[model samples]
Target chain A: MNFVEKKILEEGRVEGEDILKVDSFLNHQIDVEFLNEIGKRFKELFKDQKVDKILTVEASGIAIACICAQYFNVPVVFAKKMDSKNLDKETYESEVYSFTKAKHYTIKISKRYLGRGENVLFIDDFLANGRAALGIKNIVDQAGANLVGIGIVIEKGFQEGRAILDDLGINLHSLAIIEKMEKGKISFKSL
Target chain B: MNFVEKKILEEGRVEGEDILKVDSFLNHQIDVEFLNEIGKRFKELFKDQKVDKILTVEASGIAIACICAQYFNVPVVFAKKMDSKNLDKETYESEVYSFTKAKHYTIKISKRYLGRGENVLFIDDFLANGRAALGIKNIVDQAGANLVGIGIVIEKGFQEGRAILDDLGINLHSLAIIEKMEKGKISFKSL
Candidate 1:
């Protein structure tokens, strides 16, 4: 987590009051080395939990989830944002609202992939409003699967995302939690 | 490559004559162990090349490219399919036509991520008509970067993807090459 926090302070871009972009190493352009550290940290944090599978959303979360899945030695199931023709017709779907995109979209996973009574670990790149994470948890609950824990690379600590998940009594772990970002300066929560 | 081929023969579902669904191991529901094999195979195929970075499209390609990047000990830069407010304004953009989605979408990568003279290895889940690969190739070329090679998990040999990349003189390697799929029977090219 120290490595991630250091990288965020060094490379992360702060835009306005609410947006922080770590595209250089976190999301758009990924650092595999750093991701390995993140994987290690996630494994350390959830070492005691029984995780059968790692679940995440498309695009950004795929890389982090896949890298972390190696540590758990489990399969990864990425919830699709768009219903492609390639996806199976029988799927577990949940509607999620994107605060940045300012719209609602559906994330889906094939019903055949997630079975009943499986322990699922949800991973994502950023946790702002916690809408996407909640959506994934909803789908897992619908399938009667147990929500083991949630792993995040970066979390906007000032936001209500952590509070929402905490109220649900779900264990959440973020590598780097941003305490504040003001006028292009980023601050991290003391872990 | 044998493992991927075997997985295809066993878990891959053939819907109609064109669709070969291997979501169980390849895309939607990802097998981390199988992906490690894929990562090793990609490294073996491009072992002689010096790859500074791995370039891939968003969503499905991100998973494969990230796992493969670990073997190459390089970073991954995945092109975003949608324009987000958070993405950098300066980017290398290309339009890609998706056969599965039946729509054309633009993919963009931040200009800061890719640099001149950087050796890039392009990776993707499927190579159908080679449109997405070519689109990514265009972005690499635009950045004045060198494309070391292209690695694909599954290549529809019956399609024009391989031939097109071959004509361009791009070094292409596919783990499983399907010669044809008819009557729910899949045949692979002799190794």
Candidate 2:
């Protein structure tokens, strides 16, 4: 197993059946050192690609993207989750449905940050239904920016997210892919 | 003027009367390298404090806190702005009144991350009205953690945030203090 998979096995908690909570290290309480290793791994995976900027949704994705940006030496542009008055007037927005929240919300990026023909690599903490990634891809399309690839820290392989992104022909690299999760047990997909 | 002050004049925008938008580098689109400088400055400001962990609120604060956490070599625990089923059941929550949203919301941090007598250094992008900072302070207090101090990238000197934090006897440091911001003009407080 790779480093991320090992970390998952060590720190991740499986709640019920669908949830593999890595909040201890990846999300809630961030382990900067471990995230740096994850960033290095991502850089190694996508080193050949011409990356201009890193894109992600707010909150969870911000930490990983910012840390990962150091290796690429690029700016990180995060799509805001809320409809705030503070956001720019001219923005590229997409509708995203959150299963956790049980509602659809709008995610936006200021037009000034993303320009036409720019290369964007979408990064996030987890990939489940791929709705959030698709929403980000929509924003990238609106800006006429190229969605070069996506880098995910963890992927729920049991879900259809991977297949959908595969159908779209987008390059995706996940550090850890959990194929099975149950109460008191978790298993990762083999390379 | 400091580096932050200079960057503010170069990149920050003044919208209407009260808003100074630093979206280009500070918020919407993040400049990772610039944030490294910010992290360095924050370290210099609070180098004496025994900070066990860095704490901040979600969304906007995550990026800055994550980047800043590197300088301190500590884990960052951010309070979730929205309530979700994904979060831990046992949490320390604080109610914050948002002037922009014009409503009250609860911010929560899991009980697992913070502990009694743990030294916490609160870091964020902006300090306005002190509502968010106060909310985080409430969480820190509930956890029985020692709030060593607060480090902010920018402080609205005209706002009551500084006064409120000062009244609570919290050690607060803001890199750039905007004393006045009118349409087509901006001024910083002389250090």
Candidate 3:
């Protein structure tokens, strides 16, 4: 297991049944030192790629994407998952279904930020069902930008998220993959 | 004007009537290089204060706070504006009224992140009405944390934000202050 996986196993909490809340460190209260480490790791992983900009959904993904973008020396654009009058005119959008919120919303990105042939990196806190990832990919497709890689902090390996994303021929790089979390015991994928 | 302020004037759009749409570079789509510059400038401004953590409202403030935290070698804790099942308990909250959206929402920060007497620095993209800044200040107060300084990228000086925040005896530091926006022309507060 990598440093991230080890940290996840140590700090991550398995709530109720399916939810793995890293709110203590990852999402709710950010550990900038750890995120900087994640950023360095992402740089090592995608060192060869020419990443011009980073893209992510709003709220949780912004910090991770921004941190990773600093390593790539690229701008980070977060997809706003709400309808805005300023964002309504010129935008690339994709519908996303949130299991946690139990609602669906269209994530929108301004055309000014993304362009044709620009190498884009998608970063997020979690990868559960791949719905949000695919939704961002949809926007990248509409913008005619190249989806170089998706840098995720945590991936739920037991789910079909990876299978669906892999089918899209996108390069996936997750720091830690949780194989299973049962009875408050977490198992990680061997690196 | 500083680099951030200059960039804002060059690319920011005066959307509709009052909303300054810096979505091209600030909030929606982030310029990481510029944000790094912002972090440096914030460090310079708050060099005297021992900032333990950076705080801000989520979705928009996460990037700025995270980037700035690197300079202080501290963590960034963003308050969630939305109600979450996971975030409903053991959190410090403050109500904010949005002038643009004409809505009110509570911003919550986990008690685990903030603690008593911890020096906190508040960072955000804009300070129009000071609702968000004050909301965060409320949380800082509730947590018994010291409000080191509120670092804002752009402040709409024409509004009542600064006046109200000044009455609270909070030290406010803004990179750029917009005196007014008339007919797409911009004016800044003379440094």
- Top lDDT hit: 2
- Model with the higher TM-score, candidate 1 or 3: 1
TM for candidate 1 is: 0.97
Candidates in order, interface RMSD in Å: 0.8, 0.9, 1.3
Residue pairs whose backbone atoms clash in candidate 1: none
Please report, as a residue range, the 10-residue window in candidate 2 chain A with the lowest summed lDDT: A182-191
Candidate 1 lDDT tens digits, B26-79: 889998888888899999899999999999988889889899999999999999
Estimate, for each residue in B75-121, the C-alpha lDDT of model 2 and write its tens digit: 99989987668899999999999987899999999999999999999
lDDT of 3 by residue, A1-191 (tens): 78898887788888877788888778888988899899999999999988988998888898888888878888889999754555747888888988778888888888888899999989999998999999989999999999999999999898888999999999998988888989988998864
Q: What are the C-alpha RMSDs, in order, of all predicted structures?
A: 1.2, 0.9, 1.4
lDDT (CA) for every model shown? Answer: 0.91, 0.92, 0.87
- Candidate 2 residues A1-191, lDDT tens each? 89899999999988887878888998899999999998898899899899999999988999999999999999999999876789988999999998867899999999999999999999999999999999999999999999999999999999988998999999999998888887668888985
Using lDDT as the measure, name the better of candidate 2 and candidate 3. Answer: 2
Error of 2 at B27 (Å): 1.1
Question: What TM-score does chain A of each model score against the native chain A?
Answer: 0.97, 0.98, 0.96
lDDT of 2: 0.92
The list of candidate 3 runs beyond 4 A from truth reads none
State which candidate has the highest DockQ. Answer: 1
Which runs of model 2 end up more than 4 angstroms from their true locations? Answer: none
